[model samples]
Target: MTRILIVGGGYVGMNVALRLQRRLRHHAEITILDADSYMTYQPFLPEAAAGNLEPRHLVVPLRQVLHRCRMLNGWVVGVDSERRTVRFRPHQGEGYDLPYDLLVYAPGSVSRLLPVPGLAECGIGFKTVEEAIHLRNHVLAQLDLASSTRDEAIRRRALTFVFVGAGFAGVEALAELEDMAKDACRYFPAVDAADMRWILVEATGRILPEVGPEMGAWTLEQLRRRGIDVRLDTRVRSAENGRVVLDDGDEFDTDTLVWTAGVRPHPLVRATDLPRDDKDRVKVTPHLTVVGRPEVFAAGDSAAVPDLTRPGELCAPNAQHAVRQARTIADNIVARLRGRPLREYRHAYAGSVASLGLHKGVAQVYGVKLRGPLAWLTHRSYHLTRIPTVNRKVRVLVDWTLALFFPRDIVSLGALAEPRKEFEFAAGAPDGAKTGTQDGTETTVPRPAGARF
Candidate 1:
């Protein structure tokens, strides 16, 4: 029996695995090994962070969808291309090897981080469900802290939020979360909406570069109208000591720093013996097969598959290409298994859509530029059609419907992210002795002046 092993259960891995299960007709023994057991629908992450969508609904269980294929919850550490084996560490045990007659390498990208000061300790990426939840909790907690504080400076710092990138993730996240925070203001009498500040700092001259210059300008105008401070052609030099310094020489103290700069292919891709492109993506043929390796194939963000539609350009790392490429890859695998001819992958760039809060959005679909409520509606409709599974589609739609009638849920569950922090601090404190000046006042750790309330 032919054995097929797929490494990574992301958009590409899950989609290809499903397509293979359908086309292979039980002739192949397919197994998918992923670091996480769930497949995250990444596009919904911004909404998840804003509480517009539930974190649970943002991911689909692999076991539920890939019913026919064996799902191994583990990390793929190494690939021995010479022996046609992959080295993986399971969740509960030591590393093991899995041999495959044919392999599909689709380990997706990770947050592309830079060596900026204080970023590692202070910043949060908006990639996974965990990160989204953390961001939502942190944002809400900031508001809570600010409302409870009497210190004007501390309140000001706590209410200030900064986003480093202006790409799809950063822009959408800022818009949605700002909208949520604005609606949540009704619960806090002390904290006014005008007191809160949302800042977007982009090194590039434009945001949503994927949507063309006109739409990008329109988005900037919309955000500005909402009082969002967008700093284009500006770079963040450092964010150390709770002080954010920009290239333009502006400095401010802020607590929330969101890093959605960009993404890079998984580091495991570098371990593979296969040829790679300049961007560290595996170099693949037009048919999505790795160069000089007939048995191994790759696609999606991790693979640099030649874009036949544009002779000089490689396919952009987006769901539009990932989904289309997965189909072609599955078909090619099926053809190879059955001794038939394989087809090449080719697709033109469809326009993009961006949601700028509730009834405001920008879209350039099929060369038609739309803005305001119509664009927002189109954005929702497009994603609703693309999100996998009837169960997910219905649930997401229900969430949207509820959002119309009910106020946004701005409750902070920040402790959930670091549940044991307080316990650890308590455990380390001096033996039941209140360490403070003797004035019958309980000793409290003095937070940094710039730290959030």
Candidate 2:
């Protein structure tokens, strides 16, 4: 039996593993090695951050979905194509080398962070489920801080939110979060929606470039109408101590700084000897097979698969292409094993869809444009159909239905971050006096000046 080892449990790796496991059952030995046991449905991340959907529902368990395939939880440190061995380091214990006959190297992308001062210490990325939920809790916690604080400077800083990047992730996250925060203001008597400063700083000329320029302009207009400061052709120079200074000479203090600039291929790609493009993405042919390495397959954000639809261009690193490319890669892998001709991976650019908030969005599908509530419905309906597993679909639908009848849950479970605090206090400091300060006053921990989660 052939040994098929998949390096990542992301969109491409998971889908490819799922397909190959079913198609080559009892014929081939399949395995998946990933840092996490779950695959995040990234499209729903913004909603998850906005409290429109539960964070748990945005992720699918790899073990549950890929039961037939061996699940190995570890980080892919390096890949040796010549030796056909992958170096992996698990959560604990020593690192090991796993050999394979066929390699599916699709170790997706990571946040593309620049060397901006204080960014590493202050900024947060909006890629994973943890970040999404944490951001939600953090945003609400800021509202709490703003409403309770009497200091004008602290109140202003707490109420100010800044986001860099105008892509789908940045735009949708900012929009959904702003909407949730505005709605949540009603509950906080001291904080009003107008008091909150929602700033979107994009280095580019426009936002939502995935959708056509017209739709992008429309979305920009909609955002501005909501009092969102859409700063175009502006970049962040520094975010030192939560004091944001823009390239356009504007400076402001904000507690929340979200960096959704974009993502680059996983570092593992460069760690390998595999042929890569200038972008560090593994170079693949139309068949989704690595260049001159027929036994090796690649897809998703990590693979620089040639876009047959547009000559001289590579497929855009998005879910629309990733999911489709997985099918082709899987079929070709099976075909190679069965001594059949491989199929070329070809897909036309299916339009784009984006949600500004609940009942607000923009979409352009196959030359047809849509906006407002209709586009929002279209966005939800499309993603609902695409999100893997019937179980997750039902849960997401139920959440949306509940939203129609009830208000969005604005409660911040900030304590989730420090769940062990109380337990540690109880265990280590049994006596109340021991937990107090030298003056016998209860030690009051200072609240974090910025987002903690």
Question: What CA root-mean-square deviation does each model show from the true structure?
Answer: 3.3, 2.5
Tens-digit per-residue lDDT, 64-94, candidate 2 = 9888999999888888989999998999999
Task: Tell me the whole-model lDDT of each prediction, alpha carbons only.
Answer: 0.88, 0.92
Per-prediction TM-score to the true structure, in the order listed: 0.93, 0.96
> Candidate 1's error at 222, in angstroms?
0.8
Which one wins on TM-score?
Answer: 2
List runs of model 1 lying over 4 Å from the truth.
420-453
Candidate 1: tens digits of C-alpha lDDT, residues 170-287: 9999999999888888898988899999999999889999899989998999899999999999988888967889999999998999999999999989877888878899989998
Worst 10 residues of 2 by lDDT: 444-453
Instruction: Please give the distance, in angstroms, between residue 84's alpha carbon in candidate 2 and its true position after superposition.
Output: 1.1
Error of 1 at 429 (Å): 9.9
- Report lDDT (Cα) of residue 197, candidate 2: 95
Error of 2 at 74 (Å): 0.8
